[model samples]
Target: MRDPNFSHKQMSAPDRLPTRGLPSNSVTPSGRNGVSSRGGEINERIADRIVRVQWDLTNLKDFWKVHSSPHRSERLAEYLNAELKVLEWMPFQAYDQNERVDYLLLKNFLRNQLSEVHRDAELDSKVLAFLGGFFPLRMANMIEARQRVDDLYHKKAAESLVECTKRIILVKELIVSEKETAEPIVALRATKNLEEFKGHWQEWYNFYDGYDPLFSYWISEPYPKLQKALQDLIDTIKKVCLGLETEDEDTIVGEPIGRSGILEALDTEVIPYTPEELISIAQKEYAWCETEMEKAGHALGFQHWRSALEHVKDLYVEPGKQPSLVRDLTREATAYIRKHDSATVPPVCAETIQTFMMSPKAQKMNPFFLGGDEIIVSYPTQTMSHEQKLMSLRGNNIHFARATVFHEMIPGHHLHMHYMARHRPYRQIFETPFCIEGWAFYWEMVLWDSPSWQKTPENRIGMLFWRMHRCARIIFSLKYHLGEMTAEECVELLIDMVGHERATAEGEVRRSVMGDYGPLYQAGYMLGGLQLYALRQEVVENGDWSEKEFHDTFLKANQLNIELFRALILGEELDKDYKSQWKFYEEIKRD
Candidate 1:
């Protein structure tokens, strides 16, 4: 799975799709004008100006971000900071609550972008530090110089390409004899960067290759030479590196974004909690799940919940039977939600739900369900090893499928996309896990709270297994990012604390950490769900809104940081210098 948090459905599918947000270099389109439009030409709000600034910065980044150019990074950062300074001119206090929410979002969004630019530059420096002087910065400058002026000296471009090729050849030799072995993760990062550099060079060359006679004559012969040298260098480094294992399916090589990186990511997600505090939140959730699991175990005539959990995990629908089971569960969960009026499930969304089997390779990374537009079912197939098959079977048992079917389809991811796609589609740029996976997880909490779906002891344990798993995700994921836990340690925690099968645990940890997810993503499930639950308490339980109305309003609001949404929903007047001060978990704090 390329992205693990992409959830209009999962990040784009469900759990596994908890695809993290856009790439550091990707541009988010600021809506045509204004963040809000009720109908024909609503008055332009300050959000419009802020998004336009994003638009301007996004364009500046387009040309400024020349591969391997520090000036590109520095200039982009300076531009963003200048925009922030420009924002000081806005009359913030005069703005209404909705306008204020946009202002806060834009401010945080800008700051988060700046932090990421810093993180990128820092990571680039670290990775290049291990490059052993093999980097061809002159080539980077050539690329940068070309972008600076549309009319380039074609002959000069060709000369530079020839020179870069010679440099690359020499660099490969230096690497081959290099005594200092780079860290596997850093080496892999360097390898990827080098490849991108190779690509950038090719792109730069091709633009003038045949189009310009002098450029073609000078660059054509040398271009492939440089490309080959880049590849050779990449190959040599991979051979020398520890973590660059391409052969083993089980090898998980993730670059741990230390505490500083984790903190930057959390800020980007608008999560106020420290990684330490978040671990505590996960601990409480784990303890609560434990208490509930015990009651469910006791109901099932077992003294310990682990015994009951194991009992449930062992009960599966045999090989060919899983597909039917998933289909039936999807219908059952859909019907149940509709019957309970838990959320507004349009006929189209329910009727349009689709299912597919996961390939054996995909199953290695995400040995569970994935959802959004379609439900990706992960059950054992003929290709898997017998042991692998057993793990898949146990990991995705009938009750486990029942617990998450709606999560990947219907009222979970499918419904999320169904509503979000139709309403406020522009806001999808701000997609966060809290809304994607969190909303799906929130429904899990909602169903568990009401007690209609998990009628049997087996079902209760099944649901509790996932609930505990989400808690473990937070603790292990944050700890991994904080440099306190290894991927293997995180995997061990899942198997030990959450009763995950070894294969599922490894796949889960691999995708969560090694895949392209932000640091705080795993925490979003329990945290985002809890935030929604807290909001539910305030609105439905304490105030006038009904469950359907509350759910509908939130779904319609699309992807916002849960904190930002809090302001919109509650109509809170933010202080001039606002931060995520919502101690949302405090309302559910237990002694």
Candidate 2:
């Protein structure tokens, strides 16, 4: 479990959205981007277009009617602003909201193309191709765009993941609906969207579910209000879908009305920690880490990082001699963080490393030091203080520093993300979350055996207790998602397992309800670990393979589902046979 390559201050996984057609930062009025001329007109136009699309997309018939009109496709494209409010607002609510929004966006986009085909066969054929070709691209584009944006603005980026979850849910629902249906037309469309959608959804759920570890950290928000809003929305949606009458106000779903309570709680909750109290906790935590490193000795660094580096280096260079890997490692590590930072990097030569070192990527790295890479940490704004929010990498360094370096940097996420990011074509960004996050979580235990951390029984006990806490978290996700656990039960489990004296754990549960079927958080790591282990054995039996090569191959695959990766790596093609079979039905419909 000892990983030496881990660095502190690492950030979380990248966004899976594409940045194409995004207005340059300069065009933004915030001045964060360099394109600002005609800002007022552009803003107004963008706003107007978003409202129109949102309005038109609500009715399935309207969505299809308008989009299918001749000469309207280009007009529709002109109004589609990916950076507008519609895109931004969709991520903050329940799964249903996400579903409605994503489906509408896609449905409308597809709906616009009706004129291209008139016959049933033609319609079916075109729809299948459009869903197959366009939806995956759209999903990937959205994920990539958000990833870049998150790199620039950490807290906002972190908060945006709620939206990412929404988008994934959208794709997942579409995939399920497409695959299971008996209808020929529906099946054809399913053939188009379901493959990539299922692949990406499984990847997100299985791997990246636990990216924001500090989601367990307490903030000043009232957990109840957000829960109520989410519940109310769900109830209302169910009623409407069932054809039951609802109050007039209920029709306007997914609005952040009455959110002031959540906001107020964020601004004023009193956990009552003195500055001295935090520093005292930090001292205890820091000492604990030191003890772990000592026990782990060289294996901590080598296993987590250097060994892996040597392996990959062996692919090109001499086996035991030191290579220039460290310099490239440092540069790559820093650039990863610097790219993910929302705040500007100043040109001060004196503290350049230290300056970029405060990024979320760096904070995530603090957990992995003996492993020798940097961590990348990220969380929503409320968990971060205002100053920290503004400066991004600012505030109490020791807190994020410890978390990032120990958890994500050296032995952790940085190594994980770097490998994954490099391996695939751009589309793979949307593919790998569970593996990325699961690997980081696995190392949390690995560090406990480090020499520097085992000095005190309290440190050992604390780390053990924390692991138990994480275990509880995983169980909660499984039970909740599988429909066996209720929100109340989830809350009770958190209190019992993690000593939920802090509101952070409760907040995490509340957020979980808004994403996927349940808490598939730990499912990624637990399941992914099993998958990786099995795959490793299979490869070993087939051909002699190094762990380093496996690790590199794993990471470079860009967070693809282990199953999908297995197929691709084992020299199997993507399942075009099933899709080809699906195309037959489309051809049948067309003729």
Candidate 3:
């Protein structure tokens, strides 16, 4: 039942973006604002209208406090649809590239929000359906009423609370008496939905519990009874449905969003390629990485890439010396990015890079590292078994650290945050992992192409290890969400294809598909990388902007979607009917 692959052209041997070498410490930002502060050519009137609409959304959301209420949901959807129509009809034919791009991205954002509303409602329905057609949504109605500051009837409201309590008791009894139930995701959502309903009831109750003496007099007794009944229902469902009494951190449980859900999310990111097309691109990248690894392996006196990978894994620093190693690697990468003029490294970003060691407990879920503000280093602790200690050490080897240290520190996530805060900072609301993570992943590709970054064959292998890992992430994540692969299959694919440690593979799989992330997250690393890579070709490699100029412009644009960013950089003619169809990667045959 696997999906067929689709077309996306790629370079047989990718070329580098241009730059002139500069000294490391000499890399200082120009102009008062931050980096190369070329006076921006923004169309103020059009841009302001878009921002004004964003503020309208902000105010509207502030008013709609009860998110799950059918009335609020319908109202919000209608509001968004109206905005979409206005933007659709708005005269943008005379606007410049920058203004049209702003218009284009905002329109897509509204459309994505609407589609996601439907997706969310689909999930919400599972909760009520699992409860056999009763979900206690009356409390959300009360909550909405409170949000509106409607005239409160103390006696009637108290009776409504008593009725909700009765409903909770009935649901709890039904769960306990039932012989069968919905699938795990439904039951799991049912418990979560119950807790949410309980919270809504509390929100309705607390608005006047202490503020109005008469309201408290009526609600105080029944409120506690309803609260207790809600808690009871949640517990009973968890025990009877999930068959577990406590949270299981190690077991990976993810609700797969089918092809339609996947397509909707990709559309939101402004990614024109289908999931099948992206997977095919990833496979090509994977093949290229293998070939490069073999070349590196030969230089490392090994006949095979796997053997070279094993040798690199054993290149870890001694215990208790990782902190110093990170400090040194961060310095190395900071120097490299500047030497190549890859991107501007503000003096503050270089000085303020921070590091913190990850605990053994946290390492089970994140066996490698986490970035932004501070790089959370994951390695062995004093209490771990010998096997766990060795796995952690090899997983965070010196070579591996060297490959991604810049990614976590300067010229990667840390610098990304620094620039985003300084330039077009308000656009943080429109941020996407495709830009955030893609920027970092794009750096990985650029550095790999740099002669100095990966100085040795082992260095190339170290960088290639992460490249292959990104490829594997795209494959496993998409397949899992498309119902073509299970979580176990995903873990196995990591271990078997990417050469990941069993424990490390499990951790990566869990982190990839967890509830906190969308299904396309894992695929973002390489997909985003390849996107920026292709865009670099058009803007820097072939266009008038030098590498430094291109990088500087992108950081300041606050462009969340790369395709829209492309429009801004290229300044091509854009009218109202613009759509995303950039085939950034063009395939070439290698000798």
Candidate 4:
């Protein structure tokens, strides 16, 4: 189930509001901030009040810490009073459209928080009313409100079902209109739109099933039917866009950027390796890894890999023993990077990273580390089955942990996020996984060559495991998307070629295909890495530039397709029809 507040894409203003029930006045007007006729004074007053309330709430020292304390009710009451004070000041009808939307969203956020903190049914009703009044068109809010009302009143479930039917009809209209567009580009756009709509609708249904027992009981049968209808529409649209029935189809369906569309979208050159080429690369790495494992007194099989992983796990802090391991490792990596002057590590980034245990429900997903200002690490719990425990430990051993810590934190994702947030905020819409994932992968390669980080053969083997995994990702993901491989085949490839445990390989495949990541995201790790490596060799290694100089320049340039990045750094002329010419992987010498 999707968290209502969480979105994988960066939240736009409209996204912050409820998707279904937005009021007529909710949409922001084009010219200016859509100032109301009442005057600027009122708008300023409303904005000022919201700002002050936010400041007051945020400024309270240890406020969040107090949320889980024994006196939580008392703290919540005080917080609600402060929030009410802000709400009292808001002139919802008098403010500009932008200000009004902001005011409503803020109000909704506060109300929702209060309801959750206090478990107050009355407050929940009030929230429902507030959402319904402002966001009347949104199906998600309507369903939620209906459920809450039904819970409170013991009403018949027919009303919510009717509302669901209405929503389905409306969506059907959208789907039909979407398919009416016959032009390839327009059809492709429609495919994306439908996919997004289906995802959101599925989330709405899943959220109800997971969170609201009453709603789930009534809607259980209808939910699967609705989901299938959505999927059928999506599949139909994809078929038309990809020109599957045509003999000389040009488009890749759902992907507008061509066969190398992912690369083009990332402003990168086409990936140099074919499926066979990538498989060969993975095989070579596999053989090398086998040699390394033998030297470490392990053999080249699943059992030996498991034993080697256990040995490495034993060397590190035992799972669930202490929270200090990640933090200590992060600090050590930061210090090393700074000492070598490899790249600038911002103080804010180093200080702001927080760590937490991965939840049991999320264990099957096998999330090793998720990056933001905070990095989330998954570790095995006491309640986990032996297989689950093995899966967790197999992929997050001491050497693997050390190899990936910098990639998730420091001069990797955290630093990249920090710099981009401050310097090139507008370029966020152009974000592609290639540039983002590539940058981190490039650093892994860089540190591999640096004796300071990969000081031992074990560390090198750990690093190589991930490198080989990245290569395998490109091969398997591309094959899956091209209809040459199945999800099971992809899983087997990971297990056989990358030495992943059976469960771990399955989880990896699930994450790559069924998760929020795009079709090309798996490939981005290695392909992007190769793009950066080639660019570095051409510019920094050949031209007059130090490693630090090249890295600083690259980071500051913000996220761009590797091709445009090259053009910007090299001062090359760019054309609208520019296509990738560089075959980066072909230049590599494999022993």
Candidate 5:
């Protein structure tokens, strides 16, 4: 099956165009305001049309159906071509930097879409040209540098074994020199080089791993030996710089401890919580949630808390119905948020959030509302068995649906994406899951603190289930990556600790491990939320800014690395050598 996430463009040849002496027409005017009067009008008109077409396409009951259809692809390509032709007549120089960036990004996205549908070398060349025009000089230089490295690899492919070995030795020396320095930047550079070497070595090793007569004549045992050496070097460097070890030490020691990929990517330290510490936190929250469930059971007149949960799950709409319980919950959450003026929901986002049913193939994963004011609610299909429907509905109960709506819409991903679309278009490249997922998760924490939303004990329990789930995500995902836990163990942990149904727990584990979600993605929810929370305490809680002021300011800053977000919020001057030292989670009280 085709991966729904990626486009279908197949590369033929590399496009390497130098940045110097690019046509002057490609350069945009320098200013914060988008474009001059006439240019702005034209750009706005084009952008509006694009948005209209996109909305029309995305609002379909089966958007993916259209996406996968050949006829639909042809039509889309035609539409995009017409749009590109209109854009070509507009003078790029008249537009400001932000407008230019948006225009280029839009153009690139459209062209890539077109390319996926119909492979065109000419279109690909135009796409590359737009990319060169869009990127800053520094970024272009970096791309050129990478291209040169690729060129060298091809050059060595035809060379003698002796020459290739000599080149390898030179690269190895460079790697060792970079690793010798203890500076963080140097360590980072060394890590990147090691990664590059590993890729290059792997390609060569694959050809020689088996007895391929054409390649075997030239390649020898030295190839596998070099691969092993590169692997060892990579492992060693990761251990020293990333605080990662090859084996789990928790069994020998009392508690598990290691650096998390998520924390490292966010430029933060490993959380101060040990495995035991995290387990303790989870246990406390779990017990509190159980108590809340008991109270809810009594309030609902149920014999047991499990019965209350089951009843809530049964509140979902029947299989093929509109106005899903989830949708209703979202509307309620949005109305409440608006009443309190907790955060401003952009008018566009408020109007554009449309709910659609997830396809059968997609229903295996959790129902997700993506960033762009679009919600995909998973429901049982007509062909599904009774057991499947029961499992599906039970996994997404009223309380769970209510708790998640705000996280995915309004003041969560929708609002964040809306702001990011207009402001700091150039900085969109710097987006990380830590900021994106973290911002949404931060809203969850914020709404939970507000009494207006989480009024009922059941609602509180629902919210806490998600919070504890995030904590479990951190512990389980990190442990799995560190070779301390298996996917089954992670699933069991969810089922036992968080009261997840066996099927739901298995699905969650599968999604976490099998999907494109990175090693740090699961951890990002809780960790990122805590990071933002810590920043809020330092900035807003201290009276430097109001809660609304802080949140609005943060949205305006665009998606940034957590440390960069801190630097921007605190008005700290940053230097090239600056490293993350902010232990935001250190002072966080888990319970």
Candidate 6:
């Protein structure tokens, strides 16, 4: 049986307040002297506070060190000041959940401890760490979200590529200390000693975190029709710089960068048919989810509906009552699955159990099972109200259902969790979200494109579906996060570029910008793809290479961003440009 989804909107303001739950004597910070806090100076007091935060984080890491209970992880989020939201809108019962606290709560917490906290940098770092843990899963969701949309305008893709280029320029400007630019990265970099890398890490996080939303907002909310406009502007600039007919100019000028040219390009792109027919096609595709769900023995009557409603409300309203509900619900679902023989347990879940059957190594590792439901994947449909339910479902797709299973459960994310369970020594580093998420994100394309899944026409279609989603994700992310593309423009782009409907496109746009960890969805893929591609190229160029060798080495290595991975494989050092630069950060210097 698919796992039940949870909702956080059911949580009241009072329930979310972090009152009386933490250990009262939690390692008191000894920091003082506003100057030390404001600037990047490392006085004893500031050092002590940083150490305490790290220690507290380490404690949480230790708690999940060798265990396979997503429930326990959910509980950890509560202590860490966060809530979870799961969406159930598809027949495949795809998982989509957001685990995060209110931005206001975090903002206030930072304000209260302003003197000792490098607020922006510190907050960004923590958020990055949190999101990084689930980076790949989120990226898959974003890509799926984009593909489900029915319209396709290539301009959206162009917008994303341009945004990435612009950011590259922005980082280059920062490295060179260009005038009129903020210096968050530089401030963050100031703390990069062995004892202070975490602090320095926050500085880099601060720079990207603040910039991401502003960039996303331009594409998403206020002016939601920016994609075509931005694309046209870019095309116009390209035309002006390197006359339209010149190949050399084309290479030098690159993609479009402005609005007018993109708008004109969008206008000229002909729609294949009526919008109503397009919507109908999308609806039919989405209905497969319901069919699949029923086949898995999901009873979608009033009883299940009522129970779902009651269960979600109680999750936060009566936190005291959650354990019983969770237990009873999980038991009932597990029993139902056993009786029906419809719910297929994944390979990784089985592998985890086998490994933990307790060989001495297994005992030392203490591996265990984490139910599929506990990770809390929110579906695209749950956010809709009664009137919008049909429309919402119509916008959903199963393109990433298989990819999700691979990335979240098998040789990808679940593997990361298994490693965390088996290897307690690296728990502190292991808990870092970027490493976890990055690895999973890296696999979405890797697994989808693998020959194992491409054996038949049906399989090929599935692969294309996934590829389409990835393309859409790239389009939506760039348009929303960087190019300032709007939902309508994004929808039009989807129609023109990938053939997804407008309703689906709008949903993708909303999720890309509005949801927690949304930015990471795009950033993770960009970062992960860059890393995987660069590594494969490095080995291929350096020696007689094999995909099997690359795959095995990648799977066994530290799941951190490209920097650490490149360092291990190629013997190169990298700067914080790990977040950007497509090649290893060291490669940027070489270039």
Estimate the lDDT of model 4. 0.58
The TM-score values for the models, in the order shown, are: 0.85, 0.34, 0.84, 0.57, 0.55, 0.36
Show where candidate 1 strays beyond 4 Å: 1-44, 50-68, 132-134, 144-159, 169-185, 202-217, 246-249, 301-303, 589-591
- Where model 2 places Cα greater than 4 Å from the true spot, the runs are 1-404, 445-459, 515-519, 533-543, 567-591
lDDT of 5 by residue, 94-148 (tens): 4432233334444544544454456423333332232222211222232333434
Better lDDT candidate (2, 6): 2
Q: CA shift at 143, candidate 6, in angstroms?
A: 41
Candidate 3 vs candidate 6: the lDDT winner is 3
Q: After superposition, how far is residue 327 of candidate 3 from its true place, in Å?
A: 2.2
Error of 1 at 395 (Å): 1.4
lDDT of 6 at 225: 30
Local error of candidate 4 at residue 91 (angstroms)? 44
Q: After superposition, how far is residue 412 of candidate 5 from its true place, in Å?
A: 1.0
TM-score of 5: 0.55
Question: Residue 5 of candidate 3: its Cα lDDT?
Answer: 26
- Residue 370: error of model 3 in Å? 1.8
Q: What tens digits encode model 4's per-residue C-alpha lDDT throughout 425-485?
A: 4344345677889998888887876666744646765776787788788778777766677
- Candidate 6 versus the native: TM-score? 0.36
Candidate 6 clash figure, as a count: 54
Q: What is the C-alpha lDDT of each candidate?
A: 0.75, 0.36, 0.75, 0.58, 0.56, 0.34
Measured over all alpha carbons after superposition, the RMSD of each candidate to the real structure, in angstroms, is 8.6, 24.0, 9.6, 17.2, 17.7, 25.2
